[model samples]
Target: MSTDTPPPLPRQPAAEAARATEPASPGIAGVDDTGVPAGGGDAAEVGRGFFRALFDLSFRTFITRRLAAVFYVVGLMAIGIAFVVYLVTGIVEGVGALWFNPGAGISLIVATVILVPLFAFLAVIALRFVIEAVVALIAIAENTERTAANTRR
Candidate 1:
């Protein structure tokens, strides 16, 4: 035998050599590539992520459903309060006119007779609107609560 070592064995083909050099892709035994695990973290993280997404969706739905009605009611109450202030101011001015000039008392009397009934009608309507809005808000709350309970189940 010769003292020098023999040359190394022949090199593999390019494709085979490349594949052999690289690590094999990881895989699940019973599942496809799409079903492979994330390689880190506990299973409970999946459940937590699902719940967070669900809560976000529910909150968005609730706001979308009630936002219009909530704004409408708020607008109605604001207008109603403004009207009440106008009525009060009108009455105070009329009183002042009557005190300073008795001749204007007849006009004030006529205005009171006409405007008091109109304002009363408006007030009644505003009260009804407020009551309806409150009822609707309560109904929405109950419905949302029921939906949340059902979703939990």
Candidate 2:
């Protein structure tokens, strides 16, 4: 037998693939929170399937990809809550000290007003990238599976 590698599949832009897929309806039954189809499995199927996959010893199916969107949203919300808490603490502390040291009080107030949002924005951007990276990896895995399936045919 000849020892030769097959050529790689051609990369197509998603816009081109969009033409092949069915038009997206607002509410798809088997869709994940990320709005992606959950492998065409409905709620009961997902529940049972996820449970089975969760216990899968061979580790074929992935649960992280399905839950990544939820984790991302939760992380963002946590940062937002922390931002509010920090802002409130700064405001209270700064205002409380206004009577003793006007300059320092004003400084604290200004820093709180400017820095709280700045830091939160930075955290959000960072979280977004981290989540995106994870999602990207999941997508790569999925694409690899698709390619493998096609190659078999």
Candidate 3:
């Protein structure tokens, strides 16, 4: 018999291949294909879900992911306010120091101008990291829940 090889089987689409290889993850309850809450960021739907999750005695859903944006804004505002207060105080102190020692006062002013903003920037960065960490944890929880849902079949 002549040696021959059959044509390779057609490749499945990426989405279909992934689906075939893994258990069908229906996703977290009320979540969409992208894993966001299913109502699609509509203000009313998000507001409703936010409140519902809060009072959910069974603890079946979470609200933090939805409120993360609000938290970030509030955190930014707090940091900004703190920055303003510190900057004002530093300038005042620096100005007052000008009466006693001109060189040291100039140095203080320069240091304050440079370092206070740097520290404020660092604070903002830190706040962002913390918010990102929280969101990441929420995503992990959602993925875990989805996996559990898949297995419960």
Candidate 4:
């Protein structure tokens, strides 16, 4: 029997793909301190610009509103994993058996299993709220900066 290769998969038109990949015009790109596009700046300059933009009031608020739920879920997952590690360590070290008497061990484990997740959920919720508020404050500062610039103009 002769071996045969499969036909090539469909592909995007080269001209269309090239246009999509081209960088934005300088007018649309953010200017670094040196008056060049941020993409052309040195690593330190770019880093500073990124942080500045991140902390800008409007941007910060936008990010916080859009990402708070995602961050909260991630925090909860992290705390849940931490609780698992703690439980494993306790069991491995015989802390449960040593600290609790008779049926108390089972009860303690049950309580821990339930309470750990509840605490983690509550903590994440609080953290999200705090982060959102901080971001909002930063956004307000950014808005003030813009207003000042516009007034000056």
Candidate 5:
């Protein structure tokens, strides 16, 4: 027998070995959260399914569904405050008028002209929020249905 040990078998390239032996990443392969490989499914389909499930679980659905109600409450509170302010100011102006305070009348007119439109603009914004919220709610519902269907497979 030869004194020197035989040279080790030629090593395979790391990249080639890794490619041959390693399974694809979870989403890349058909593997789901359970780590069981999905049976011979297209990788793209698997990826799409994974993301759809993720989206369904996200808060997008919850915020969308509740947004309209939240905005409506906030808008109501703002408008109520505006009305109360207007009423209080009117009362103050009336009392000041009895005392012939010109400054109070001028200030009251300025506030009425400027602040009413500002509040109206805010109301319009709230309405827009309601619309957007409704759209989001619909999207969430549709997504939930799709996800459910996918999971059944």
Candidate 6:
């Protein structure tokens, strides 16, 4: 076996390597990049960046899902409270008024009270479906992107 080690590979100069790795521009070229110049302290630029971050696809989705969950819970609670109130009202008004009333008004009110719970329940279910549908669509998009990348490779 040869005692000498193989010669070290030729190395690229640091500056040349840096130029090859980085884009020609060191800082953001415009509002599209959303990056403030180095040492930039402009409040206007900061505000733009904040809004840009909020408008990003990932951030928007996060906010949407969080708000949806909050609304879902609040809706469910409101429906439960309404059901309880309706139950109490039916009991106080006398259950006979729901089916039999001298005037059509009491009967309509009773019917509305009963149907409101069903409508609210359906609304909650619809909201849940919408949220789940959004998640499934996003997952499908990610899967498609992954498959595309793998195929390209």
Listed in order, each prediction's TM-score against the native is 0.35, 0.69, 0.73, 0.47, 0.36, 0.42
lDDT, model 4, position 7: 69
Residue-by-residue lDDT tens digits, candidate 6, 88-129: 665556555645664554765666677767876786787678
Residue 20 of model 3 has an lDDT of 86
| Candidate 2: stretches off by over 4 Å | 1-42
lDDT of 2 at 63: 76
Quote the lDDT for 97 in model 1: 86
Score residue 59 of candidate 2 by CA lDDT. 80
| Poorest stretch of ten by lDDT in candidate 5 | 59-68
Highest lDDT, which number? 2
- The best candidate by TM-score is 3
**What lDDT does candidate 3 reach at residue 55?**
99
Candidate 5: list runs displaced more than 4 Å: 1-99
What is candidate 5's lDDT per residue for 1-153, written digit by digit as tens? 677887777589788998888776634355454323454668888667556655786644333332455666776777778767776776577567746777777677667667766776777676777767676666667567768988995
Better of 1 and 3 by lDDT: 3
Model 4 ranges with Cα > 4 A deviation: 1-45, 48-81, 89-95, 98-100
TM-score of 1: 0.35
lDDT of 5: 0.64
**What's the TM for model 4?**
0.47
Candidate 4 residues 1-153, lDDT tens each?
Answer: 666988686588888888888877633357443222346658898677667767897653234433556776787678778878866754544445646574666666666667766776777778777866766775577568668988994
lDDT string, candidate 2, 1-153, tens digits: 876999676588777887668556545466655545656557898688889989999887777777877988999899999999999999999998899999889999999999999999999999989988888887788669868998994
Cα lDDT of model 3 by residue, 1-153, tens digit: 776998777688788888787755665467665356667668898688778889999988877777778898998899889888888888888889999988878888898899989998998899889988988898899779878998995
